[model samples]
Target: MLSVESLSKSYGKKEIFKDISFSVQPGNIIGLVGENGAGKSTLLSILATLQSPEKGSIALFELDYKSKKREVRKHIAFVPQDIALWEDLTVEENMMFFEKLSWKKKGKEELKQLCSNVKLDRWNERVKTLSGGMKRKLNLAVSLIHDPELLLLDEPTAGIDLKSRKEIGNYLKKLALENGKMIIYTSHDMDEITNLCDQIICIGEDPFYQEILTETGKNILSF
Candidate 1:
């Protein structure tokens, strides 16, 4: 559902990626694994259309990101490593606001259901009062408000407890299995990738280090 071809990016004098290319099929969960400076996040950002690559192109569901940005964006959702939420708004209100922005309008019940789906139903309190995990759940819920076809999640389970991490992973797996949504996620946790991804992509300083699989099987990497 997503294709990235000849993707390369650099920050001033520092080069992160060169000719990085990959494709994600429908109903597949792709795990992006790499070291700290391996360009995982940069590649994701390019796919998310948040940052333009210095070279190469991205296409989502056949729509070229550079030429059909609006249409591509409608089918893509991005969940960043950091939680993005309105701290002062009540949990329900935050969900409602984003739902309206993304989906025109969503009933209270529907919003509540989404919250529940992400295990945030009990967090009806104001966002400022919720714990970090609660806020992360809120972030996940917001990303799904539009029912995007391609979901890009970056370090989504970072800093959360084991229980919440599992919940998030299970939720993502359900989305791919039940809804056939294409998922591309970046993570440092080997266990999460082992459990949730149908295929894994290991990126490093050299593009040769990257590998894609077709099953949830582990492959050891040699430096």
Candidate 2:
């Protein structure tokens, strides 16, 4: 489980968010939704342990963020809004490079399987030569090399075709239900969010609200 309490951040005198709190369970996908400049990306960065919050605390499976940052990172993977890959490298090459960088490296065959899981079959194709959808798929595949328990994605399917978006959405469901991976994703697509997430955390909205949705219905609570 992931727990966040009283989280807050600020840049100089401008405050981003404050007193934010939420928890994520295994086998659940939490959609972090908000309008532009709502600190969605900034919050993800803090959860990824790449940035520090001015207040509050975060923990994963009871491991405190301040005291066990490295351990926390090991169990989570962060995929940013921007693609993080070498455009010049082939699909297979990119997989191998990321694998080698992981603390738990896998064999070439295993690395290839990771890509296969995401349906990225263009092994020899350079990232620069692949379509936007294919590139997005490869980006996701690369992040699975370490097999983290949690995935943090920021607009992962943004600017992609419907087919690609559907494929990514389906795979994320598989990861959560079949593999028990916790996910926190951000997207502007309401249909995708409604279909993909088990709950919604809305930040930076007036009279702050967090809506928890299930198959039955949705409940809105003001914070």
lDDT (0 to 1) per candidate: 0.83, 0.87
Residues 117-213 of candidate 2: C-alpha lDDT, one tens digit per residue: 8788899999999999999999898888899998999899999999999999999999999999999998988779888888777777654233323
TM-score of each: 0.90, 0.93
Give lDDT tens digits, candidate 1, residues 1-223.
7888888788999988788777788899988888889888987888888899999888887899999998888988899999898999999889888887885467889889989998887656999898788888899899988889999999998998999998889899999999999998999887788888877777774544344332434543322
> Could you tell me which 10 consecutive residues in candidate 1 have the lowest summed lDDT?
214-223
Residue 90 displacement in candidate 2 (angstroms): 0.3
Most lDDT-accurate candidate:
2
Worst 10 residues of 2 by lDDT: 214-223
Task: Name the lDDT value of residue 104 in candidate 1.
Answer: 42
Question: When superposed on Cα atoms, how far off is each prediction in RMSD?
Answer: 3.2, 2.4
What is residue 53's positional error in candidate 1, in angstroms? Answer: 1.3
